[model samples]
Target chain A: MREVAVVGVGMTLFGKHTETIRELGEEAVWAALQDAGMSPKDVQVAYAGNALGRISGQEMVSGQMVLREVGITGIPITRIEDACASASFAFRESWLAIASGLYDVAMAVGYEKMTGATTAQIMEALAGASDTELEADLGITFPGVFAMVARRHMYQYGTTREQIAYVSVKNHDNGALNPRSQYQKRFSIEEVLASRPIASPLNLLDCCPISDGCAAAVLVAKDLAPRYTRKPVWVAASGQASGFFEPGSDVTVLKPTIAASQSAYKQAGLGPEDIDLAEVHDCFTIAEVLHTEDLGFAPKGEGGPFIMDGNTAIGGRIPINTSGGLLSKGHPVGATGLAQIVEIVEQLRGQSGHRQVQGARAGLAMCLGGFMHSDAGVVAVHILKA
Target chain B: MPETESTENSRIINEKWFTETPQGKALAGSRCRKCGRTYFPRKRVCVQCFEDGRMEDVALSRMGRLYTFTVAEAGPPGFTLPYAFGYVDLPEGVRVFSPLGGDFARLEIGAEMEMAIGPIRQDDGVDVIGYIFKPV
Candidate 1:
């Protein structure tokens, strides 16, 4: 195995867009290539991550179609899908291609056009990520799943609704500093609490909006990284795991996240205390709380209070979601995982202006895809160092 | 007689999910004869023991405890808004995801719940009957 480094990262402003999926993919890819100081001809292999292209009328050969716009052809272009973690898996594969000495330079792109579909259509499509026959057919929406988890967490640990609502308040404040964020406006705790209820214990403000966007990253072998950029963010570790179905499993802790994060921490020869910052999956505000604990940043059942105390805020003990997270930054499904990586890369390279964690050297990114048997169906955890 | 044959305005959501035993309508599940693990909606093989042809059909308990729940204000197509659903932990160690009936406010964790069959939602002018849990 060899070392891999992220030389370039790019993302479109996450929100509603009239641009086609291919066009969105092109924008991010072009920006990434430009950032890396490389042209399309420099890429050896490409991986594209997309979840709802079929719903948007682009079903197969998504990678080929998207890369064709950037003049990236006659190469091994594979389409990867793993629900919301689609892009993260794509990045993992790209790292593998370089680490295994199969390719020196590889690119990963994740794009999703969710705005074009109807609310019902989009909801139905997102629900497909779960056990369609067992859960979706029973009409359990994503919010409902998280709502149940929030309720259980509250019941088990005395976590208050106010503490959970505080997560939205904090992330939106960070998003306000990010020009590319979807919802740049910050909200008060009372305002977030008073927002229209989507599911019990979780209001509208607590949920991430449906969005359309794209994010891309360029990775190369460590030995060749300095040729493209002066500040290369090394891929310390990349870990991915799927859920195990235990009927009576605890809903509060996502086992796959723990499994993946443990694998990542071990590979990186680091612990949670060593991380200077993190970008976790906050598809729902409660999700951030869960990931905080699952990633070992907070003790189990203490994530709500840990976040409520401002421990995870920017400039706090360990800043989290400086990119505004999926909540305020907007969750474009397939594009979310790579967007997280983009934020970490920028933070490590001292590119994030106001939201930057001062003197940060190491960062972590965690993403969850789908819910199954009362837990996340898939999880991916990655560690990056400056 | 099979429950589906007796109803005209409604039908069970999945025919293989329920069985009419002497004790009344009960959830049909598969038990791994090799490992004694059980599953709801049945299974072709035991996921725990990974033993083929070592599974037996069994009727699940009608009563269980509410593990967790939520009142969903919105859901996918065909679901009525503001409906309640939850996980019911049965004595067989199988957690069943079922729609909750009766007063939503009264639904509490660790509360005893009994399984009941009713219309869960409407599908193209017909009631999609399925199993539900009501406070006992």
Candidate 2:
């Protein structure tokens, strides 16, 4: 397989968007094209990732319509949906297209218009991310699921509420530094702990909000990258895996993340030690803790103390979620995956002003979608190097 | 059956996967005869052996140990807020998500729980019968 590199990445501010979903997709796509110093004509193929487009009263084939509005037409356009990992999977597909010598230039775009719907409507749509047949009917939501994991983590590892709250405090602090983040105001640990409880052991601050936004990235063959940009973040590996129905030893651990990260590490020929920073799927405070451990950054059951010890902060050993993660950046679902990749690209290029990890050479982006059985239904992990 | 009877009988949510017996109502799951693996809500074929196994209906164990749990102060539409729920690991080796019955603070991991079937909530003027795990 040939090598692939991300030439340009672009995204709207991670917050509520009043524009139509098509316009949101267009803006991000145009920004990515401009950043790559290319035009619509340059894109050989395209993939759009969207999860709840129907919630917007749009057609199922919404990707093509969204791209067509951006003057990007006549290409083999396809829509990709993996819940929150929609755009990340789209990025993986675009990367594969280039790496497989299919297309020299490709684009991946992910968008979600969540704010257009009512809060109850939005909640119902997000609930669809879980197994409706087995889970949602039981009044199970993401917060409920993550709360169970957090409770188990606390019970098994002696993790404290203060330790988990620290993840929110730290991420909000970083989010304050990011202009694109949703919640710019820094939050205190007390503030997070005192927030409205969504589920026991997890307050509203512990959860990522229902946001509306979009993200896009332009990828090209490694050889053709220099023509578009000098600072090309090479796609080292893309690993994706599905969860098993079989019950595992512990519900605290996300088995699919561990499985996917192992494949990513093996493909990249690198381990956690080699990673300078990462933008993991911190949909909840507990999620960050779990992903850090599953990604091999911290030892099993040590993720709580790892964040409390400032190991995941920007200046820490392996800075995770310098983009404020989904916690503060706001989780727009479909667009979150590409948004993480876009952050990694910015950090790799040394363009992220306040949240930049100093002298970062390589970074990892982990995105997960849906809950199946006892774990994430699907998880996609990508390792990128400068 | 008449249409009126059918509609009333459909009070049981996910009827095919649930059944009533003389002893008690239990969740209906499938056990693969080939590898003896049990799955909740039944399965058409055994995922373990990848061959057509004689899947038989097996009433899941009515009692299990609470694996993990949480009390949701907020819930989706039609669900009463401040509801407590969690995953229960049954002796059948399948973990099921069910509403927790009894006091919220009293819930703990490794606690014994028994299955209870009744109206989970009222939907469209009909009681939605569902499963839950109650502290023993």
Candidate 3:
């Protein structure tokens, strides 16, 4: 395969959206095309990632509808739905299209409208990602699912409630600097600990909010990169993996993440130590801790203390979730992975302003999708370099 | 007689999953004749050794240990809140996801549990008989 680079990236402020899903996609697509010094016509192929479009009343073939809204139709447009990692998969596919010489320029867009639906409606829609026949039948919500994982981690590694709370504190602090973050206010550890309980050991503060947003990226062949911009974030590696069904599998270890990260590191020829920063799928506070260990950023079971000591904060040794992650940036589900990519590209280009990691040359963005039975449905990892 | 009647009359969540045996009500799983590997909610073929895994129906161990649990303080509409949901590791080497009943405060990891079938929720005045794990 040939080399590919992310020429431009764009994302809307991750919060509630009053407009339709197609409108959201249009705005992000326009912004990305403009940033790339190209137009909608320049995009040869497109991929859209939307998880709950049907539940939002957006019918199937939503990709074609959204593309038509942007005045780009009749191209080979395919929709992807992989729970939370939907956009990451789209990005991977976009990278493949460009790397395989199939398309010189491709666009990947992820959008979701979560706030337009009622709380109960949104919960039920998200529940579709789980094993509806088994787990959801037990009335287990998302927080309930992660709480069990947290409980297991606590039982196995002596991880404390306060330790997990520290992750929220750190991410919220970073979110305070990020204008695009949903919650910009910083919360103290005491405040997080005292928040309303969603599940035992995990309060409302530990969970990412249901959000509505859109993110887009423009990928091009490596040789054509300089024509679009001065600095391009090269797509060094892309890896995706599926986990085994949860039954009889270990919960504490995110096996898909472990496998995907190994593949990404191998493809990139870089290890955890070489990463300057990272954007991880912190759907919950405990998730960040587990991912840190699974991605080889910390020793097995040492992720709890790693954050408690302020190691993951900005200016620390290998800062993580510098854009505040899904916890504060808000998890728009389908749009989350591409949003993480947008941040990494911005950080690498030194355009992140206050949230920037100084002199960052390489970054990793990881997204975990869906829960099947007990394990994750899918995981996608992307490594980017300047 | 009541248990057998409920299994026949009431709508159990995923009927193919649970079966009432002479011993008692247990998860209806399938064991591979070739590899001896077992799967809950019975599969048509073995995933591992694919040797025409024509699985034979077998009852899973009713007793198991609570691997982990959580008390959910919130839930979707039409569902009971503040319920106990968890994973139970049966002796058959398969873990099952179910809602737990009995003392929530006393629930501990690795605690012994046994299978129990009862009403999980009421839909339109009809009780939905479902599988659950209760403290042994």
The candidate maximizing lDDT is 1
Interface RMSD of candidate 1, in Å, is 1.0
> How do all the candidates rank in terms of DockQ, highest first?
1, 3, 2
Q: Clash pairs of candidate 2?
A: none
For each candidate in turn, the TM-score is 0.98, 0.97, 0.97
**Model 2 scores what on Cα lDDT?**
0.88
What does candidate 2's lDDT look like per residue over B45-116, in tens digits?
888886575998898889999999999988777777788888999897888888888777779999999987
Query: Mind giving the per-residue lDDT tens digits that candidate 3 earns over A279-313?
Result: 99999999999999999989978999998998899
Chain A, candidate 2, TM-score of 0.98
Kindly indicate the candidate among 2 and 3 with the higher TM-score.
Answer: 3
Worst 10 residues of 1 chain B by lDDT: B1-10
* Deviation (Å) of A104 in candidate 2: 0.8
Per-model fnat list = 0.76, 0.69, 0.81
* iRMS (Å) per candidate: 1.0, 1.2, 1.4
Error of 2 at B5 (Å): 9.9
Provide the TM-score, chain A, model 3.
0.98
DockQ of 3: 0.75
List, for all models, the DockQ compared with the true complex: 0.78, 0.70, 0.75
Candidate with more favorable, higher DockQ: 1 or 2: 1
